[model samples]
Target: MGRRILVVDDEPDILELTRLSLVREGYEVETAATGEEALACLRRSRPDLVVLDLMLPDRPGTDVCRVIRTTPELSDVAVIMLTARGDEVDRIVGFELGADDYVTKPFSPRELGLRVKAILRRGVEEKTESEHLKQHGLELDLSRHRCLHRDEEIALTAKEFLLLAALMRRPGRVLTRERLLEEVWGEGIAVTLRTVDTHMKRLREKLGPAGDLIDTVRGVGYRFRE
Candidate 1:
């Protein structure tokens, strides 16, 4: 089967439009008009990715995302939040809840489709031959999508994992913000440089003491310590 996607939104027009666009892109798409229905569908069979809306009639999308993140069966499912509100706080909250990406309302379906493709691609891209990376007291299992610090498991969102993987793959090389954005986020997606910083901050915090491995290069960008 093709890549599966579940789009959750209360707006029928938005759901239909998104489904149509994604179907045209060859994704097998399913949609839910309420958070309840979304969860029901998720329980039946998990999709590869979920396009979740922040506002829902049955329950807040954040609630659904939280459930997905906490549920071991659904934790690895990639989520892209759809919101009418573009506030930084909301975005931060969404990310904190483990959203893989965010798209604001009045968005172009084409661009959103591109973002979906980019995110899905990033999930499967193999950056290294070895399945495990051990450096600076941090261990990343590429195949398992798991990270360990001081032998304790560190939970990371999909984007956080990708961002850390990118940096570790090129240790000692300074990766500019623009470069990191391109490598991790892909092209044609609308996202600010600050978004990279935000994820990096969270990524560092999750890495605990090993956080120092990712060094800030002042104005240029960040680099994994050599």
Candidate 2:
């Protein structure tokens, strides 16, 4: 009765290990050994969460994630990408491709479970907030965690919203990248400051004409227009 999870990895041992760990915690675990297989499984089994490996025998994991995102049928599924190392570029790219979270290899099973649980919880909260944010015009509803700009609903990822809230809280005041991450992502995770930059760019583009709302501070970081 727990959330259904699809874990995509080529290594049999890794797949079994993940399956056992999640199964023990009562998750309905399904797995795929290749990118192609994962897509097929997705059609048959709708998983609440997908744990994907960046390396796949067929298409790369990033491509798989992108495909899932482009396919309207599968866009809503939450994804956690498994990386090979502290490859920062892949991490950012995965996020851009719509992976909700990421974990490095040799990762702790407990940590992955916690990440999965947190993502699922966030998804539910975001859905509720999105529904409530329809009233605000071109402004973010922080209480409900949603954004509406010029009466048009804006789809923001978790990190994007966090970044926007940080910039908006100090409208017209320039914020350094370090400070933005410190405020938005918190001082935790050791994430690169560039993560803020990446999210900001995406957020701006999504905001359209309101995109100008996020102003780069040239030598410093950025600021939200007042």
Candidate 1 — which residues are off by over 4 angstroms?
A: 89-95, 126-130, 133-226
> What TM-score, computed on C-alpha atoms, does each candidate reach?
0.56, 0.56
Candidate 1, residues 136-210: lDDT per residue as tens digits?
Answer: 778889888999988899999999999999998888999998998898889777899899999999998988888
lDDT of 2 by residue, 4-93 (tens): 999999999999999999999889999999999999998788788899999999999988988888888888888899987867655544
What TM-score, to 2 decimals, does candidate 2 have? 0.56
Each model's total of backbone clashes: 0, 2
Worst 10 residues of 1 by lDDT: 122-131
**Residue 150 of model 2, lDDT score:** 79
Q: List the residue pairs that clash in candidate 1.
A: none
Q: Which stretches of model 2 miss by more than 4 angstroms?
A: 89-95, 130-226
Lowest summed lDDT over 10 consecutive residues: which window, candidate 2? 129-138
How far is 34's C-alpha from truth in model 1 (Å)? 0.6
